[model samples]
Target: MIKPTLDEEKKETKFSKKYWKYDGLHVISFTKAGLREENQDGISIEFELNDKLKESDDRLKGYYLFGVYDGHGEHGDKISDDCVEHLSKYIAKRLYELPIVENEKEIKNAIKKGFDDTENYFKTHDINGIKGNKVRMSGTTALTVMMTPKKNLYIAFVGDSSVFFMSSNKSKKINIEHNCHNQNELLRLRALRQKGFMYSIKARSGRKYLRVKDDLSNEIQYTRSFSDFYIKNFFSGGLIAEPEIIDKVYSAFNLDLLVLASDGITDRSKIFNKHPTEIYLSYLKRYKGDPNRFVKACDEMIKLCDSITEKRICVDDMSIIIIIILNGKSEDEWCHIVTKNAEDPEDWDNTTHEDELSDIDDQDIYNQNSNEVDDFLVSVPLSTIPIEYYDEDSAMNFTISDDDNFD
Candidate 1:
């Protein structure tokens, strides 16, 4: 697993110029390569409000954007990098172009169109690679959330990357994992099978697997993602690029944290009989509502995962975005955001705000280098097949073994 050293953390103590704080929200984010040879995950967090908002459209105020992408196959990284870079533009265009009314369905349609346009853009253009090889046949999962000051939270999710909205008491999963084993996903594949677009098979272990069939009798692991035109061509309606959109109204006060993470973090097996959310909540409690809860959480993840026996460690690239809702909001902010218990003042962890640090550099925290994690040695081979685990705890943990080889 990739673990940051104290020196690296010290050097990065400077607040990223892009880091912004509004009336009651602090977005803290980080992505690590984990055990993967290459970091195939990509994340983006943007607060397009106040000075960050475009002058032409001051109406775009109070908009917060968060995205996470997990790449698969050899050219997976490019797919994620491109998806995030372009999707942001598409989302912004829709936000600014459409009528500003809170039309949840319309906004979701716009986001779907954005994903389509991005995928099409990849198909038409050639992405130049270091070895002069054009990236072609790769796919990535995408998850995006848009929070408007209008008290609406919109989510456009595809593939397996997970999204969780955490309040003081519970953290609810906002999206589904589009994989062969998921019951909903299985239903989708079955529906497509009726159209002769997809099929399912049972392995020797009696485990059923969904696959997009090819002319050569090859059965590829099924995923709804952007690109991988080869699968698109053969699978009929087999693979989809359309994202599932979910819209909800949340109160600023009731919400304690919003977590967006790649499958690497969520898809790990249970350790010590603890669920991922339970473990995460443990860290949140330890931090006592600190603003840098995300940073501290990631650090703990590295430590815990590294300490685990090799077989149970999370091996894929891990990325996370933590939206911490600061205290001291007006009564109006708490109206719709109902909460059972108010946070205790004594529980607050008082610490210097990162932005107030004297030696902090003006570099952006969400820059490209934010996800380029290093320090740990060894990389696991890339994997595309989703491992199915019956138990929820097992589902959250991934096997990261050095001796394992992929053909």
Candidate 2:
């Protein structure tokens, strides 16, 4: 794959702070560190592909890309910023060499490899080393989605960042979070024989969570990420750098809105007072699927987070990208084709609003019940503590300690 020019601006002010667009797709993204001292979140929405690339390959013509990165640790900012700067260029180069067929699998693989290449570059590079001349390790949850000309959707992700497709009737989540407390993630860890080294802790807030330690006896909580910690043998492959990939083709675009967000945007413990789904659906309805209203909608959400200092129980980095798919198109013409039904509720399936809520709740029961505190894993690396602790527990027997409490 041919790599794009690396003229990535390191200064934060160099990137666009508003939106990106193509023919019918419009994206609006915003990010802030919230109460944190520095912002560690990174984001990129590339709906406008290069004209030359589109001309060379018709398949690349109308594809749109959206991504979010929530970085952690000392160099968290660098990791997220670097990934956003580089990943698209990586994918474009890869696609340039492939045959121009409508191959969803190949496109997904190319995206996966782009993620892999970016992570590998950081892990092996000596750019972010500490005073002791040792490399510093940090990680970020990544969520990315690509929308093609054919309306084929491909999602690639790691950690707790999320993507969702919404309609007037229902909203569906598009990504899975990789956390030690997640049953599916725990099962994968067990299959990798890494579960034995994991231990659970009860926080002062009455929440129970898990942690994995580095050789220096530092702890981490998230199971999968784009970090060098796993490569340095600080954790197992279960806390992998690779992302889970998903591919699907759409016959017509039934989606009214597409939301991509970091954990900060969805944390229910905070003063936001409402769920992301409810807020998003309400925003879509308020705007009547108008793409121009996106900036105002996002601004309103940001105001909700900023207005919460008095009752602020939870605060972290927040980033969100909203895509209004029906923008510039006749919603009346496309709605029926997309939903495959008339707009009137009485003519549709016989279900009450209560029944609709129940169906949604049943389908996404696990996510709906998950706590915001579980979104992060204990990720204290060896550099955070004394070397003596490592010597005392060099055997690395995965067991709980008296200091495991978070309160």
Candidate 3:
């Protein structure tokens, strides 16, 4: 138990909530760690939630799982805590109720509904004392993955939290992050700012601000025209909509490993280390199949990722879940294939980075040809506090199939 001294007595925290789920085929374990740093701006809290799901009973049902949830804010702890728990329980409960089948569309709807409902649930509840009841509001970004034996896998996202999949064919990355950074989103932010609307916080590297992010412009835009926080921070990852599909079907792509994480771990390939999964896996291959060692390796990697002197979240509460598909291609196979096919123009541009792609996301690999076009339009969009269009009409915000599979 944690006790408070006289100075801390007045600011004691007495709140806790939890949720978990594991099937007969896999053993999923998660560990959380965080850092609180003092800054001139204010107190910023950065934390990471990690997960490892392994096939427990084996029996062909076991597979390993990896995931991370990094949220910012001193009081957003409740939101982060709630998001992880809600995410796990929501996915488990919905999957448990679904019929055994490879209906990718059904799986999509299940996840979409889970997020939509979760957001609605929070909106309807009276979160009076949850965060602090004084900081205007408190919440968190949601990033998660679910791997199943039916030769399936799925992921959901709310913010910049990302995923990377590795396979012999290729490695894949996705911007499931539906924020103001998308092509249209950037234009919108600019229009809004030009119209006199934008978050007030300055964009900085080390400081964690409640302000929204504009992809085109690192800092939130400012103009004298349209100023709608609801529209400015317009997209949400929490319980609003189904996380944009990073990869819709994992098995279809023949993925070998996956890495799900928050932006803090390795943000901007141009900045921090470009690939931690590759780095960790390089040293971890010899210890495959052991949960204890696997977990230890993960924790150690996180510590190495963090730096106490770093102003920002060193590896910022980094969380990473690595899933190793039993028969998936090995790193050597992938490297050999890449080198062999490097000059194969016909295959190079279209290569899905199979080994890396599958585990990173549940992307619709078959639609890779189409997604390439989307890559051009890729941008991050943000959502406002009480989403501008959040109401009875919000249902229309999602143009999902009534019969998701029918279409």
Comparing candidate 2 with candidate 3, which one achieves the higher lDDT? 2
Best by TM-score: 2
Better candidate number, 2 or 3, judged by TM-score: 2
For model 3, the local distance difference test gives 0.38
Worst 10 residues of 2 by lDDT: 357-366
State how far residue 213 of model 2 sits from its true place (Å). Answer: 11
State the lDDT of candidate 1 residue by residue for 67-126, as single tens digits: 988777678787888887787777776667667676776777777887877878777776
lDDT of 3 at 29: 25
Best by lDDT: 2
Q: Candidate 3 regions off by >4 Å?
A: 1-34, 37-67, 127-136, 176-181, 187-242, 268-273, 285-300, 308-315, 328-407
RMSD to the hidden true structure, all candidates: 12.2, 10.3, 14.4
lDDT at residue 320 of model 1 (Cα atoms): 67
Candidate 3 residue-wise lDDT, 143-219, digit = tens: 66656555566766665566777666355664434343233333434455444443221111111112222232223
How do the residues 351-374 of candidate 2 rate in per-residue lDDT, one tens digit apiece? 223211211101011122363332
Error of 3 at 312 (Å): 5.9
Ranking by lDDT: 2, 1, 3
